[model samples]
Target: MGRRRRRKPKWVPERAIVGELDRRGRAVVAAGEDGRPREAHVDGALPGESIEYLRCDREGPVDAARTLEVLEPAPDRVAARCPHYGVCGGCSLMHMDPDAQVAFKQATLLADFASHGVEPERVLPALRGPTWRYRRRARLGAKLVPGKGKVVVGFREKDRRFIADLSTCEILAGPAQGPLADDPGRLISALSELIGSLSIAARTPQIEVSAGDRELALVLRVLDPPSAEDLDRLRAFAAQYELRIFLQPKGLDTVAPLETGRELLHYGLPDFEVELGFRPTDFVQINAPLNRAMIARVVELLELEADHRVLDLFCGLGNFSLALARRAAQVVGVEGDAALVERAQANAAANAMTNLSFEQRDLYKEPGAFEWPGGPFDRVLLDPPRSGAAGIVEHFEAIAAPRVVYVACSPETLARDAATLCSRHGYRLAAAGVMDMFPHTAHVESIALFER
Candidate 1:
């Protein structure tokens, strides 16, 4: 028996009168014909542009296609900075100007609110930060291609799972920015080359990257153990580049340093006179400067007083809790991960703050299994993951806090929760706005305030 040949889907080239940008930042068009209009999302286009695209994918209600050419360009479109702009899935909206990018995201957030009949009284000015070289955390895919006889390392190609063959990246927060430091050597090329030359390149599937205030680290996800010679090569590479290397043979918890006695990864919050630490594999914001700005804005919306007690939900390693403790009288930080809870406890002790505490419990579990924290809390803050705090938000009445602030990564979830808070609960949606946390991508990070 022989393997059957795979048949390629036949694509029909069609020109679309593209309309507004959808939630994912792709241009939408009316594709249906039976007295109904179904949105056909076309990439590589802006609003009002006529684009030639090949329609080949059907994603539920919407058809997906990649743009072949823009028959007419939109006024807001701009030249992309990186050469790998369209191919690299790491960024979308690079063709649109920064202002336009933020505006599109803002519209997306507001429109989501409008759909739910929950409008913010005021749209806070979108929180903007440095657009390029701002990503402090990333995971680059590594794959060994036998035909090319090389390991391709970078972000996955758009609409595909394979890694893009990248020589340089404009958005990676690599080292060497001072007057005399070399530019070309500090970015993606050197890292890609180093990984390519390794003996265990095939077994290494991905590399996790993290940057603190003063240090950067890399953790390689290796499926198999490396040989003694492979260790030597990795060590030489690390020493030459002033890099910290770790290897994970299995789970994230299994990550171990290639070199011992190294510094623990950490970042500082100078605004609150606090410094926090974490493992390289831990979750942190992709943008550092924006995270700081966001925290300030959050504190403002929270309106914390010296006598007020704050409840921080989904608090990972006290990122916001420690800062909140600086202003509020008492703070309780709750997390699902026991390790992160321990880290949060250690951070509170190190900061010499006795006003904050962290407790570990799975927040998504069925109700009544876990006791909701009974509170005379004056303020509440929720920063749940994309599966926005449904099980938790419905229970906020138990806390009966006068104010609530939500930091969200998904606008859809945020809007849904906003409606819940307003309709079922007595809170009002006061204000909401987007943040450029992952600039150039359609990933929306936003904040909202609710008052009773």
Candidate 2:
């Protein structure tokens, strides 16, 4: 018996809806004659701007939408520098002026604090640096579309799974500095056939970019081994652009340089007289200048003394541990990744720092499972991931650190942790402010000082 013919789903009509911007910089409107208030999060929107958006779909209690037109643009609204601004998902908030972007970030932090019924006693001046060409690391998507007859390399499209076709990236390939920076499209196009061949077999899907002060490394995630001819082509391309190419067949541990005797990538903190060597895939700050500034700020806020001992948690590769050790009598760093711990230890030794030490432990698990030095710690520094440091915060009293400084990338998680440290542990939020670690985007990197 023949099955009944299936009908295609009707397309949802696009409606022009207007709304005011909410704290998140999204155009928001309550339930009204226009549409459901919860349904509108208009992209490319700024506060105080009346924008027209096409309702797309419902996302939980909120409505997802796309900005159609700005009937009355906000005063701070400016032209986005990147040609791929609206279409590329890599950056948002670029429409707003750079200064306004920082202000919005500060406001977001304050609003998050308010939601938790807490506020910082003082807010520090926002820290900022070069907004463009500041990104030192990026994971670019690589795909081959036969229909397009080329390889596409860049970020994914906004709110979509498909990659956005990009010739160059302003963020990573700073201001046409070199062949790698000026025309990344040429690099991808040159290697398109090889990449496309592997991609068709579901072998290589992504390329990670990590640039140091002098060197740039591209780690290609390959699902299968490449032929000798492919290696020759890759080597030639690498030599042409002065790029260090590493291929990963399965895991991060499997990543190895195409040729032996490759140079190691490193960045220097001249102020602290410290240089840190790292693998391309390691977790280093994408913005180099901001990182130097951030380390300085953290050290200043901690008020480190030669006699004071510091504890650095989530200390990836001893970026903070080595820096703190330079000032403090002793700095102990703990991280979950054993490889990072080894790297941190090696970094300390390379800098000839005998006072700093690092340990490997799953901080989220039972603290007692791993032995930690009994601490009458004078101060503590935390640079946790987005999940926040709930595990560490829960055991603050046990550590008995008089002062605590938290560096966070997520305001929501920071707010949650702040509440716990204050209400549950009798710590006061002394000073907090946003850092422009990621500009042209909604990401908020913040630091908060807490005292018991």
lDDT of each: 0.85, 0.81
Best candidate (score: TM-score): 1
* Least well predicted 10-residue stretch by lDDT in candidate 1: 176-185
Q: Give the per-residue lDDT of model 1 (tens digit) for 19-58.
A: 8888778888786733334567888889999888876577
Model 2: CA > 4 A from native: 1-25, 33-38, 173-202, 368-371
| TM-score, one value per model | 0.94, 0.91
- Candidate 2 C-alpha lDDT tens digits along 326-426: 89998989899998998898888889989987888888898634456747689999899999988778767777677999999999999999998999899
